[model samples]
Target: MQINKDRDWEALYLANDTFWDHGEASPGLVDYL
Candidate 1:
């Protein structure tokens, strides 16, 4: 999959901000767990 290389996307993964608790868990896999 293609990922965004934009500053905002970088910030999220870098812990500058959160998009789903900063990678706590992917909701899609939560059901299997």
Candidate 2:
């Protein structure tokens, strides 16, 4: 799963081509902020 830096990640998410946590905001990010 070597995603290129130039790739459009938003498109992949919209197309459901990538894995992700389908829930609330990321806990780690919340804690960091």
Candidate 3:
């Protein structure tokens, strides 16, 4: 799926519309960091 980078996903976090959030850093992304 394509993501909308223009929208502030952080605002969704502030508003608590975070059903899609995993509540932690993604394990798949740990290596990139």
Candidate 4:
């Protein structure tokens, strides 16, 4: 359960970061890949 919670948080953070990478803050969308 603890590991799962950590994974969830990591996923959320990753998603948020990915979103930001392509969000209005960027001049244009950039694929992390």
**Which is the leading candidate under TM-score?**
2
Q: Whose TM-score is higher: candidate 1's or candidate 3's? A: 3
Per-residue lDDT for 1-33 in model 3, tens only? 347779788998899776678788888799789
Clashing pairs in 3: none
Each model's TM-score?
0.27, 0.49, 0.40, 0.28
Q: Which of the numbered candidates is closest to the native, going by highest lDDT?
A: 2
Residue by residue across 1-33, what tens digits does model 1's lDDT show?
A: 345665577666586565446446776788789
Candidate 2 residue spans exceeding 4 A from truth: 20-33
User: What's the lDDT for candidate 3?
Assistant: 0.79
What's the lDDT for all of these models? 0.62, 0.80, 0.79, 0.49
Writing each residue's lDDT as its tens digit, candidate 2 over 1-33 gives 785899899989888787664656788989998
* Ranking of all predicted structures according to TM-score, beginning with the best and ending with the worst: 2, 3, 4, 1
Lowest lDDT block of 10, candidate 4: 24-33
List of clashing residue pairs for candidate 2 = none
RMSD of each: 5.2, 3.2, 4.4, 8.2
Please, what's the RMSD in Å of model 3? 4.4
TM-score-wise, the better of 1 and 4 is 4
Better of 1 and 2 by TM-score: 2
Off by over 4 Å in 3: 22-33
Query: Per-residue lDDT for 26 in model 1?
Result: 75
